[model samples]
Target: MSGRGARGDADESGATSGSLDTVLSFVTGEMAFDPGPYNDAYLDRRVTARIRRTEAETYREYRGLLEADEAEQTALLDALNINVTRFFRNPDVWTVLRDVLAELTANNRTVRCWSAPCADGREPYSLAMLARDDPAIDANRLDIVGTDIDGEALAAARRGEYETTRTTDIAEELAPLSDLDAHVDRDGDSFAVRRPVREMVEFRRHDLLREDPLGEFELVLCRNLLIYIDGDHTRDIFDGLAAAVVPDGYLTIGKSETLPREFRTSFDAVERGAHVYHHC
Candidate 1:
């Protein structure tokens, strides 16, 4: 296809069937997993974004570059996945989480939680903070697992470093509960979560679309991840997430996401505005 046509086609339908087939073949051949679960529009955007970054003249050229360069393949995979996240994002949601966790662990000594697609560890780390602060819950008894498909993001999570700008909003959100400084150590332009908080979370590489549940948990946070996936895959993923939650356990999704119609009867809304639900 002509370069202009390729660009125009991407804008209209993400990619021509032939180019998409080429790209998908290359990715699966190299990465050993299908990118088919993601929405065409989402894939198109990421593919075009990578094309622009590489300054390739056309989709054909871009596919050729991907086939030739292992580094480009990795870069394209990273680009296709969303990794933008922060600590204590949407404070109100955290508040709902805190209340639910408090109630869930009211009679128990241990509480387990999972944060799927926990990019950079901020979300699970935030959960760790709540567990540490709750008087009814013992920090020693709290176990939080953070899983993501991106090794790079997991590495950053392990490093526990963040720039001041990234933590500014988090700091503001935490000011009402406790001093943000107490949970993070500031050094120069970056800050790191305290060792105690970091210790509460364990990071692992996981693909929600293909992998089994990390294990049953009392709470599961799979927020801001479903929007990029197509409908059938989204339902498949939701089924896995629902099964991962213990009976009466809680599941929380992104503010903008909702439970699929098939799942609405199985999970009761605990906090509809916050997208928190109870597995029935």
Candidate 2:
């Protein structure tokens, strides 16, 4: 519920969505967006213009188009989405994950992880590797589920096959930053997750803007995706995520974003520089 929806007087709401405005509107209403680079006018204009090329001329008209055509809507969503991801993209976060797993496994049951907005399929797969390679971590005991709103990304995630050469990039990932590094066998030709590693993850299309958590998790990663969503939606998402994690579970986000002050009380910072948090 970003500032996108109509206010009390303007809206009599149950639930409604599917327009460029719907996304833009939600973000603005829900979050205090960066007016300069990520402004309301900018978001509306960009979405409108992008859809217009396909004959969706106006914001309202685009809404009609989205509502009238499901496939078209999906395409529109794909078009608007920003999925800039890489294997083990954030060195710092990966560092925290490795340490946290080894430390927590010492006392926990099975470790459950949820990767939200798992775009194009790298993050979760990389995580699967972490569990499989770490001796202290019983890969069989780890279950990582990746969720994204886009069906395309979910499909890719399910396939679990990437060009072999892509793996090389991860081998030296964060090399200069050893304290921030997580061992990765960056060999792209061998990039495909082994069947066993793939078995550890479940990928699904979940609209974090809308859905509730299906089960509890020990660790949850909602990264770059939320920066696009407005505060209210982010808030709603975090609330749902919080409830979905065990009382002592961990909640992790991108190194760039931090939980709101209100939520800081709910999860404690487990690793300072790597930006990991655990339920208090």
Candidate 3:
């Protein structure tokens, strides 16, 4: 496994090295949740954190806990899903994406966009807001699909609700490009995306590791999720992503992630700083 867990030898909990494998097998075989796509290290780190939090003295205990507690299963899956995101998280990247969408939708043609692992629907909904606000783009013709492995996250996405405080920050941060005032209806303490904007986006449950890319897209935002994946499945995943983009379409990845060297011929680096590539 991932070499003695996250706590190293200091971890007195019986959930030591290789114990995560036993837990994983139990979750898959008994709990009906498969974590096969995750790297050993990533799984160990995330699962161990959960183990510590649940105060399970041993990996065997954690396995038994998972069997008895449905909530723990959901909690463990949430931990592994790693939903770290915010609306317009990077303004500079959104600025670039705006321009890219402009060119892709030049003739009022329908352009499809995929935000895989779209955490809590913020990214796709942000894209919709941006499209709706930009007069130059035909927002009605834009189609955005957000997919994530977490069903709980997907449920939240469909609800299209967010804390007013977060949306308020986005309104100020994003400025003239887009704002919540124009795209969301405020409730008591939260905001919900307007129907027009929500209509442009759809959410689905998808496992990026085991499933095929959903469809061809003019823009694919597969950011932040690749780092947790190990090398064994990296290239195959990259190959699928490469194949999913329409010719000349764009693929934007996390700042920390890079295209595999072998894909240099298939996708040309178009925005080096933003880690965007154009399918050639």
Candidate 4:
């Protein structure tokens, strides 16, 4: 749902130029949400879905509804920011991460990590669990931050809980590094991250496209979000990511994503298939 391009660019999704402008303007001016960095087709699809759900005949009417209803505005923002994630999402990549974490914590210093666009806290909590269970790592020195533009998702993350289905992968691939007692507590059909793991992590609301990198980190996981960005803005986002990682620090992107051509030299691929990089 993130891309950057001319607002007047032709869109065959059926939203008229004037009406689309009206909607985008209100979102930017009033809500402080910038839609300019989102792909047009993706934005159109999300906006159109909202329009249909609200039964608004035109984008202008949708804007009117947005002005009148705060809840609808939240819904629209949620719709625009699509976040798909799961715990220990890619086991192989996480296998590589095991070595990375051990190496990062070898200095016995605080290790800072960021999970950008972290949906519902699964990824960062997964990292915490890994750090906590691994005897070689000092879990007390771990500082993890999970950020996303979706207000609702951030709230869910702050709760530090997830449905049973969301945690199935832990049993499948991360059982060795997982300490259910110290990391999670199961209740009925759901699970909540235990105090030890939850203490190491914090969640914040951040917009990658509109805001600066939160700070430099030893590890940054900006997985799976670059696919939706347009080419020009993709480079910009990648640059921001590069800036966020300390020299020789690690940056892990989605397996499906590649480093933009210009960044190939600046970041050496530590594990090409896992999409782990060492910033130079």
Candidate 5:
């Protein structure tokens, strides 16, 4: 009877020690910001994964490690923010952007674009390539800014070097439209974005949730970012992005993402299939 009681008490204690709220509180209090904007299940899954990696039996133990080790904090944050991206990803989206660019540069000398949460610079660099290939627009006239919350990712973006597999992927995707070899310089097993394309884009560290959009942009690409956020926060983020675009400018989100119902009146869908919306 005594042994059973002791085991029961230990189980209860373990459960208490691994409370999700405790881990969240520690992260929020220590990080000085609420990560609640992210989906709860997504956060839980990542936290669980991190706990497993750390071999911590309880959330409390993991929280202690997060508090004591800066590396662990970075690891946890990186795990939470999924940065999976590829150049010319979702080819149809780029086709819409190319058409938009043609119209945007018709009357203006320079067309400005902002790629928010631009992981590893692929999206913005892809934009630069499109502008370079377009006869209507001079690549030099494109002022593109790629911003991400991860400084390390931004650093990688600045390097502009990608493995052969990724470069090959870009080449295959763009083969129908343009010669990929023209835009990249190949090194043994890696490829570097050519100077022309790399020069047109500037990569910086920016947080979409914490900071306002940089400035008025002719096009804003916020793809593959909203699915991680909860509904309310997603709406709030859309509001910020809509406000950032010029009156007639274009906003392209992830193919799977949709604007909140409240924003239906503000933005007219330019291409329903491509998820391109024009700010009114």
Candidate 6:
């Protein structure tokens, strides 16, 4: 009777034999992005429903299911990451990046930029053009890193093969695609970034939440990512990012989101809808 009742309790709570252990692993383990504030019940719903596996399982038992098969890990991580990006996204923002990079490059000894959660190559690549067009900017001195939790996506960013479709926005900002210097390198269906700009960026699979994060930067572009995480997780990342920026450096977030109230003292709003942050 006692054994049956334990199972009954687990079943009623939608936590059968550790069924969602994999979910917890994703939040707290190697996949790296912080999980923030997941109350036990929220974990039960979000992870269980996210996996679409049987929900009547406990975290401990779910740990065993994960142990039984390690391959399930990637799919589970994929469920939580949100990848929504387009070339030269939000024209005004691109204009901001271009103008900002151009000015910073002119006077700064080194221009270090990070595109966190950069989906494929759009954001960093756009930064490349900002350098390419500005004669004062020496492409060699540029240090741009594109990091993401998704290995597959990071591979694509390194390859630099983007659909011709993403170029729709580029024509509006710079010269028509054909007139631009780099676009001239495309051979067929896909285009490769020319070497000078290509040399400036290096892509690596990085878990922003878990790994030893890089220390400092002139600008950090982490757009549309905070919306997926809870307030606690958001605050933790904001704290790390705040520390990562030079006292005079800048931080950027999604346009619709605001930094946690605690962060307001550390970061100053550079531009509002443009979603740019600066360490004042």
Best by lDDT: 4
lDDT (CA) per prediction: 0.81, 0.66, 0.80, 0.81, 0.80, 0.65
For model 3, residues 1-280, the per-residue Cα lDDT tens digits are 3332333332654445326666887777876666656677788788789989986866777878888998999888778779878787677788788888888888657899999989899889888888888877778778899999888889999998877464355445446454557888766766778888888888999988889999899999999888888776777778778888999899989888888888888888776677888888
Give the TM-scores of the predictions, in the order they appear.
0.85, 0.69, 0.85, 0.79, 0.84, 0.69
Task: Compare candidates 1 and 2 on TM-score and give the better one.
Answer: 1
Tens-digit lDDT track of model 2 for 1-280: 3544331212344234244445454334433233223334435555655665777544555556655776765564555566767667786688778877776677647888888879877888777777666676666667788998777778887876555344345345424333322333335344445676677788888877667886898888888866666566677878888898788788888877768888888788987766678887
lDDT of 1 by residue, 251-271 (tens): 999988878988889899887
Q: Each prediction's Cα RMSD? A: 4.0, 8.3, 3.3, 4.3, 5.8, 6.4
TM-score pick, better of 4 and 6: 4
Identify the superior model by TM-score, candidate 3 or candidate 4. 3
RMSD of candidate 4 to the truth, in angstroms, is 4.3
For residues 1-280, what per-residue lDDT tens digits would candidate 6 score against the true structure? 1111222225565454433444465446655545454334444555565445734245555455454555655555665554667666777776566656666677647878888889887788777766766665565556899888877788888887665555343344344123465542655545667776677788878766666567678888888777666666776777777877777677888776678887788787766678777778
* Candidate 5 worst ten-residue window by lDDT: 1-10
Off by over 4 Å in 5: 1-17, 31-33, 57-61, 64-70, 136-138, 165-177
lDDT tens string, model 5, 1-280? 1111111112576565656665777777787546778877667778889988986777777878888999988788788777889887888887788888888878747778999989999989988888878786566667999999888889999999887563356556555346778888877767888887798899999888878879899889999989888887887788789889988888999998888888889789898799989988
lDDT of 5: 0.80
How many clashing residue pairs appear in each of the predictions shown? 0, 22, 0, 3, 0, 15
* Model 2 worst lDDT run, 10 consecutive residues: 6-15
lDDT of 2 at 152: 78
Report lDDT (Cα) of residue 272, candidate 5: 76
